[model samples]
Target: MGERKLLSPEIVQVTVDKVNIIQAKLKAVQDRQKSYGDVRRKDLKFEELSRVHDVFHISMLRKYISDPSHVLETPEIELRDDLSYEEQPVQILGREEKRLRNKIIALVKVLRRNQIVEEATWEREDQMRSQYPYLFQN
Candidate 1:
């Protein structure tokens, strides 16, 4: 057994009116928010102007102060006539052997003069010994 309760015509009309009023209010709020958001929204469409690089308007750039500590101190190196200076080995840091397909190549981590420890490079042990014989004296 089920109770069949029916709504009156006046009550149905009142419910429809309330729903329309709520929908109207919701639409008004949505339109207001959309208008506010559209103010800050940008319609970005990119078109390539050049093949070399993308060009940007200079006005978009901001002036920035260069860091004083970023300037590196230039090392005093005696350059020869051909714009090349002889790199003197300061110290031998470490030694390792790299195994290839057929043979193993001996490498020495050498720290050069007037350079930081981080700038040390790995050089072939045989070539380094031949070039700077004094480094291998010890």
Candidate 2:
């Protein structure tokens, strides 16, 4: 004999909480974009690039992404209140970009679990070989 399980109120509440959390994250990203558009940076083209440039400083990003211990070894950043408002967006972008990268990794794992490889692959190796940052750089 099999028993039927019923949904508890706590489980329903947890689902609702998760949705709310996701909505808040989306709103935060939208807010960052709006503020970004409002700012004027001569070096940056707002229309061409949005938050994607957040991690353009690859060296700093790699330190955080690949070597967490190194980042932890640095002096505490929170105690320094000397940071400017302009610096906030850059930090936000780096964090969001890292989150996006992590999500991509997670997605790849899910795809593998489903017995599916990449959605699209390079048809030719020669064609796929392209220039590095130079190709996409300003």
State model 1's lDDT: 0.94
Q: List the residue pairs that clash in candidate 2.
A: none
**TM-score of each model, paired residue for residue:** 0.45, 0.26
Error in Å for residue 130 of model 1: 1.1
Query: Quick one: best TM-score, which candidate?
Result: 1
Off by over 4 Å in 2: 1-4, 41-138
Instruction: Name the top lDDT candidate.
Output: 1
Candidate 1: clashing pairs of residues: none
Model 2 TM-score (2 dp)? 0.26
Worst 10 residues of 1 by lDDT: 46-55
Q: How accurate is candidate 2 locally (lDDT)?
A: 0.43
Error of 1 at 49 (Å): 36
Model 1: number of clashes?
Answer: 0
